[model samples]
Target: MAYKMPTQKYSGKILEVTVGSDLKLGGESVLPFYGFDGNIGNKPAIGMEIWDIFPESWPAAVLDVFKDAADDPLKWAAYCVEKYKPDFICIKFEGASPDGLNRSVEECAEIAKKLADNLTVPLVIAGCQDNDKNAKLFTKIAEALTNKNYAFLSAIEANYKEVAAAVGLAYGNIVVAESSVDLNLAKQLNILITQLGVKPDKMLMNPGCAAVGYGFEYVITTLDRIKLAALEQNDETLQMPIISPVSFEAWKVKESVVTQEDIPEWGPQEERGVAMEISSAVGVLAAGANAVILRHPRSVEVIRNFITEMTE
Candidate 1:
């Protein structure tokens, strides 16, 4: 006799946020990959992240994969989309940082326009993690690419209200609200952003992520709590779809960046980095990230396979 598994019905579905024209994220009425228990609104999406400035410090493994393309954002992005076929391209304007290139908002906006015009997939514009600078950067970029919809990498509570009004209200571009890995902060940001008229359907949430072994359990626990709040408890604010940027955190860790000479038994540095990225990415996806941005092609390949096996 076949054992029948009972389904735990959920109250609300995660809002579906569209990217790159027809591609949609979220929409599940139950926990991620528990389709037997409920509906799977959409299969998870993956992205490859690149920087506007040459990532001179990139690990040899990743640099080898990108090679010449790493020298230019447009070339880097083209290479990623053509070779790896990520669901989207996350263009981090690291050069715009006041400490880095200190590029003016006007200059960064122009570069963003170029990427938006050239890329086949949707663009997720990322700032250099400076709240004040991002407020200006996001606004200028949003103004530049009006009507040509794209997603922002994030709008933290510190600046999301203003960003939500500018990109979301002014240009109708998708907004992403980010909060540290805390359910209360996540819900609070959602509430604040929505108050400014950004619909959940037009917004995504980023529960700030950590490297696989570095405070990563907090991320998983936070994601799990968000799922519990939204699905069973019917928490509206926390129901926004989650997008986790894995590559930045995964690649910067000591395990990924340390050299073979520095640590003899750590195996090949490239393979180790890719393994870290894959572990962190898959961990986030399983923990309820609707989208994850990875760096290495190999990590994307492995995670894509994992997503297909689980979703299909």
Candidate 2:
């Protein structure tokens, strides 16, 4: 006898967002990879990260991957695109940190313009977390890439007004509204951005994610709630696609940093670090993230294979 599939139905679908020239993300009518019951819309995109300045303190496992191109942002991005082949490139403005390089906003904007001009894929431009700096940096980037239409990393409730206003200046650009692990905060931030004249389709959410061994469950639970609110509760405010900077947070943990020499029982350093990132990426994707920003090439390859298997 043939068996029937037990499927779950959703009342609402996540909004479809087009980035770059023609890349479309999100638009799923059910939970992730439930193709038998609903549309997967688009495959979850991978945004490979490239820092504007050489990441001096990055773990060897990550730095070694970009060793040759670390000094040049443009080349680094190109190498990531050509070699690693992510769906998009996310240029992180780590140089602009107040205690760091304190690179001028204009300088960062210049880099963004050059990357946007040269790359064929979409760009995800992330600014420094400092609200004041991000406000200045995002505005300058918006003006610099005015006609290019790239997405900006974030506009939080604390400073969404300035960032949203600046990003809204670009016709096809979108903003990631970051909130704490709280669902209400996520919804509220989305509402605030839409109120700033940005449409709901032009937004993404980043409810803070944690590394696998620490608060990883928090990331999954929070994402599940946000997705449920969007798909089941039919909360229009929470319907936009979500992004998880999996590698960004995963690499910061002790598991990804501590050398095997320091702790002989931790197994191999590179393998351990990769596992942490891969586990986090898998968890977030299953929880409903539309895309994940990754740092390691191996992690990207693993996640891509996993996605391919699930979709197939």
Candidate 3:
């Protein structure tokens, strides 16, 4: 008898989302890129990370690469797009944080608008987690990018009303609903955002990604459950695409932050950092990540290669 392949059926599918000029993400009928079983609407997309201001706390590994471009947000983003050719660009409004530069909302809005005007690719804006500050920043940024519908406004949790309302007022752009590692919390957040008048398809879930060595297993397991719920139990509330903010979590760990001199056993600082980001990203992709936001151009290249190999 001829050999046969077995595949499981799924009733749920990921929502397809478009950003920037023509960047499409999600819409998968199977987990990740299991094309043998179902349709892979679009290959997982990667967005290289940039910041509104120079990241002074970044180690030499990351700092060295963007030293020149760091001084100017526009220039830095342009460099990432032109040089790295990422599927999209993600700007972390770290400067708006209370402990950071404490940049005014107006200033942050101006920077976001400038980047939106310049970058032809899709943009993802992640503001600091301060409820009041982030809500204000998100409102301004959402308004600024309303026309293009090119930006993804991050993290409508704990402040779902304020941020989701901002996106609603803007009339365009996607919202990222975030939750802790808990699956129920993740689902509840989605429901809450949907109730606020944001369509479920227009939202993406950030299910609390942690780095490789930092509770990574918990993240993997949580994501698997979420995917299973969506596919097996036909959970409409959980069918949205999943986006992992890989860099921020990865860089905070000891393995990624420590210097070679500080930890001799660890390899070169640059290579170690890239490995951390890459490992975390790959793990998430395997567990069912539809989009990954990353720092470190090298890590981006590596993950892109992995995605191509797996999908092809």
Candidate 4:
């Protein structure tokens, strides 16, 4: 007799959110990659992270991959789209942060509008890490490019009211409800965002993730808990798709940054950075990320292939 894999049925489905014209995420009625057990509507979408103003902190090895267009955001984004062909483009408005260059809302919005207007793929607009800055910037950008079906990287508990109201509800775009890696906090944040009229289908959850070996277990456990609740308990509030900004968290770790001279045992710098990104991205995809945003074209290519081999 042949051995058989056990199958399980889930009661609830993860609501699907569309980006650009056709990229779909979530709608899986089972845990990540359990296709034999239940319906998995779409393969996780992979987005490339482009910056409004490029950061100088990137590794030289990885930088070499994008050297031709690294200095200019528009060129960089177009280059990535033309070359890598990512599912979507995630624009990091780092210059607009209050602590950073403190770029004006209009300046950032103009750049954002230009990118949105030119990019053919769906755009994910991530504001600087400041709540106030993100609120103003998101609102400005949303107003400038309405109905293009863009997504925001986050609306935290602190500014859910402003973001959910202004961008999610008013502009009719998707909002990511971000919370620390805790089940209840994630659920509560989702509930709050939904209460503001941003329906589940128009929302994605960011239950927080970290690079591999850098508090990554918390990411997995949190994702598992959320998926269980959404599938087994049929928790509507927790049923939105999950989008992990893997690049933002992964590239900053020491493993990706230290030079081989600085740490000979760590091996090559660019290869290490790409490894870190791929590990973080694939780890989250297996754990539960419905979509992941990545840096480093090599990392994106590897994970894109992995997703195809598994999900397709």
Q: 1-312, model 3: which lDDT tens digit per residue?
A: 998999888888777877666877788878877889989879999998888888887889898988799888899999998989998888999899998779988999899889888887878888875767998888888888785655554655667888887775455778888888989999999898888788776788898899987889999999999998998888999988889999989888888888999988888888888889999999999999988988898998899999999999
Which pairs clash in model 1? none
The C-alpha TM-scores of every prediction are: 0.97, 0.96, 0.96, 0.97
Off by over 4 Å in 4: 1-5
Question: C-alpha displacement of 285 in model 2, angstroms?
Answer: 0.2
- Kindly list the per-residue Cα lDDT of model 4 for residues 197-235, writing each as its tens digit: 888888888999899999999999999889989999999
Q: Which candidate is the best by TM-score?
A: 1
In model 1, which range of ten residues has the least summed lDDT? 11-20
On lDDT, the leading prediction is: 1
Q: Give all candidate RMSDs, comma-separated.
A: 1.2, 1.4, 1.3, 1.4
| Of 2 and 4, the candidate ranking higher by lDDT | 4
Candidate 3 lDDT trough over 10 residues, lowest sum: 147-156
* Residue 15 CA displacement from its true place in model 3, Å: 1.2
Clashing pairs in 3: none
Clash pairs detected, candidate 2: none
